[model samples]
Target: MTHEHAFSLHVPDLVFGRGALAEVGEHARALGLTRVLLVTDRTLRPLAPVTRVETALRDAGIEVILHDFVAIEPTESAIDRAGAAGQIHGIDGFISVGGGSSIDTAKGANLLVSRGGRIADFLPPPLGAGRTLGGGPLLPHIACPTTFGTAAETTGIVAFALDHGRGKTTLTGAPLRPSLGLLDPTALLTLPPMVLAANAFDLLSHAIESETARPFESRPAPADPARRPVTQGANPFASLGCREAIRLVAGALGPALDDPTDIESREQLMRAGLLAGTVFGMSGNHLPHALSYPISTLAHRWTAPDYPDDHPFLPHGLSVALAAPAVFRHLERRLPDRFAPVARALATDSVADALIALMRRAGLPNGLTAIGLSDEHHPALVEGALAQRRLIDNAPLTPTAADLAAILADARRYWS
Candidate 1:
């Protein structure tokens, strides 16, 4: 019955500003990268962000190999392909430019190239081989984010959809984090309104979930101190970042969405994403993020604007947003004290109501029904969410199958 008495925090070296991306070559050289794999998506390959990084690397005399086929919501096969490219090119380092997909793809590629295994070999059990990392040194990676959410640059987590309905799972460890992160706000200029809005919600949810996650003192002591999980639940270190992230999202998301040219807002949102990601890296997210995995996996008819339309897709933020109001309402009732600070940050009496209002302003879909789920989907949704035990267990109160079903049921429709 012993509880954990210690916690740890980890963050990659960070450079944040308007033109921070231009320094990629200098940083890559500092990391001693001679040949680097430049990971990005086809959508971003022609963009200024990718081009700028490529030019910077070449200018600094680093050999660059381009892998621009990263999927918008990275798939296991796609990541494997990226890893194969790195192996073939004998890349000594990685530079990921784009959103979470590109960064996560690079992480998977680094793991495979360094460890000589498939992505699943490093995942948790019942889904993969559950192998632990740290066997040897992984190639250095510098993550340059184009979007304002997911914060893949600062985290040690890599999430991707498993092939053939296996659903989504994650690989997490200290070795998976990027060697450094470049948060350049200029990359957000081309973001579509809906994409911007979705990113904002994701940042918002990360802060809230981390702020209210189970306390570190509530977790059982790890049998091996060295094997302490990346997500150790809430602690004082995480709370500091969470508070600022919530405030930034509240004040800046709308302005950033309304005017893509607003560099100030864009900078704020990027900073918020970094803070929230850093917090969640320590505390982890709970029900909303867990629910999002299934919601994203099961989405068949939903396609977001300004995203790749090659397949039916749901942005990660919208899926999280669909269930956030209901989940926070449950939390407010159960832990009013913890909920109070969040409400104050959002400047609302009800955190749930505030989220709904923000979602509407951001042009997010109303609920699960709007994204093609219904009462019949609840069972599968519950099963899918429960599989994300890593995130679900982080909640202050763990939800049962029945509880998850009820939450999905309540999430069916946010407003008429």
Candidate 2:
């Protein structure tokens, strides 16, 4: 494993297990939150877990104002609306109880309301105006992640939509990490098979990305140390988390999807996601996440049974997995010796074939075309990927526009 002279690790104060949702209220109270802004989405609002969170918040004497209209990805407009609500309610603390999107929405709102700026003004350069962040205390936020992946509850990154909601970029800083993370497997028992599979897909991607990320020793020190990214590189500390997460996810994904009501499988998958997220927090994700942005942004709007019609969109994990096979194969040649263990972990000589088999079992997208992209989308995909320099730079190898185009071309059909 690569070791660096200096590296920083950050994680939320974590509470895990079946009844972990019950602890969120007390956590908020302990943090001295009197007026709290609870951000969720229309889809999750009707669930029992959300109801329990609300009841607990109210019972704790915290005045909770619900912001339930957040987009599935928490678009710029949705964050604006959430921030407006927070400003109007005069909230001193924040709570997010849903998937990664909801947790990101809460972080977005906290950053906007406390710092007072347009979201673009605080984003990383080239994506935004490259405005410097303010040195001020952000409102304390408790992230209750009902979903099994994305690990937004522990990361310092928050994304916002751009280019007419056809692209995405992130705002990163240490203050953006949640003060606490509550992982409750009971909240995930009701997930449909497809959704459950998507969550596992993300966890799988996170593990591979963490294990194969650029070595921290090779990265140059940031010019501005205060605004560092959550991921550094694949260090010894991060490798342990990534390996354990991979083991847990490899064992749990199929079982959890097949038996949605199996709380034990869900708990294990949740733990895997948390472990993976913690690793990426200190040692970032690379190409899979970077390449997914445009494919997700420009894909045909498809609706899932459990999701809202207005919220119709491809899940991020599906988009990320669309190119997984191609990515693993491409990287195997680039870092043959380093990736041998990752390939072995999946019980195969070829990481690409292993990833393809796992994704097929989970029933994820077969390729870029399966997600509604086509030959016509290649240029656009490269363009979108190029704009994501933050994620792109974290890779052990940087892809030229032509390199990205080739990957997208190869991703046109995974099983072909």
Candidate 3:
């Protein structure tokens, strides 16, 4: 099998600091945007972060069209609604000011407005029309994340749920990436403790997965260099970011959660998120993220604190955390050397044990069972995880269906 000898790193233009969000309007004008669509969720509409961005944009003489219908976890319908708003307003650009859902909603809206098709037209087969995006340059987008996890601002992927919660899928390409990412630590001040814990775990997962993903040299070279996958696997440039992110999360997550007003800890956590985000796309993720899709899609009884209570919601990070310890334990046997840096960064001999300890400290769910899954759900969980080939294939040693099933079984309960 031929292996790749080259890799590429793509990151959005970034402005990071305490008050970086206040400068978004200047950047939007620099991008030549006159009228912009501001996408956010209803829950965040009255929040300080949203108000701050709105004030900044109007202060710069930019016309803002507010679209606050974004769901907690974005869905196809939500994306279409946001897209329709953009079309109606003839928005010249997009400014997303919430979590991953809001940013991804803006991405979907931008795609529909620029490419002139439904989201399904660009999705993969069996779930979508399997069409590719070549619709010329999409409108410029500037993403401001209120949460610290998903890193939607820095990625070229848009993940959303199918209508009625059938499942989750993604639209991926360079055009989907935001033109700039505004990292403002103060945006996290309103995050609840449980939400903060989930974010920290998600940050940890990004760093570890990037650090242990299949090396670029191990992947098959693309027949066309121009078509090289956005996720190029572990490379030298990404490793630098991954290691530091792991160390920062280890030291700062606890402090930040203990005191919501601790700006210093919040700043550290935000930096950790930024570092992890910049690199994870280059390396991709592995089993835990793949497994998270099923865990979230099939959830029937779990509800998280400080989230919209209208649905049976499981925050993305918590779902990923539930599967992480089991997945990492499975990987450690095969990739002990790769996990050494992670262990050193966490100051622990066993990465899985350290994760469990952290989860306990953060008051996270005990495991999959805690979230209402049982032995009967293993088949569906395994099948769902296997369907995420993009994430599954990035593992250094890809798992077979049976391997996934066993992992699910092991993940059922981490503690009594």
Instruction: Sort the predicted structures by lDDT, highest score first.
Output: 3, 1, 2
| TM-score against truth, every candidate | 0.98, 0.95, 0.98
Model 1 earns a TM-score of 0.98
Per-residue lDDT of 410 in model 3: 82
lDDT of 2 by residue, 1-416 (tens): 33345677878799888898887778899999999998998788989888899999999899999889878866887787788889888999899988888998899889878977667667665556677656676999998888887889988888767647657777777788899998888988868888788878788888888888888888777766654556788888888878788778888888887776888888898988888888787888789889878877888566544555665687787878886678777878888987887766766788788778888888776887776778998898888888777778878788898878888888988775
lDDT of 3 by residue, 321-387 (tens): 9999999999897889999988999999999999999998999988888989998988999999999
Show the colliding residue pairs in model 3: none
Evaluate model 3: give its TM-score: 0.98
Of the pair 1 and 3, which is ahead by lDDT?
3
Off by over 4 Å in 3: none
Better of 2 and 3 by lDDT: 3
Q: What is the lDDT of residue 306 in candidate 1?
A: 73
Tens digits of lDDT, candidate 1, 1-416? 88899998888999989899999999999999999999999889998999999999999999999999898888999999999999999989999999999999999999999998889887766778888787466899999999988989989999898998777878888899999999999999978898888888888999999999999999899998877889999888898899889999999988888887998998888989988998799899999999998999888789988788888889888888998998999879889998898998899999999999998888788889998898989899999999888888899898999888888878888888
Candidate 1 lowest-lDDT run of ten = 128-137
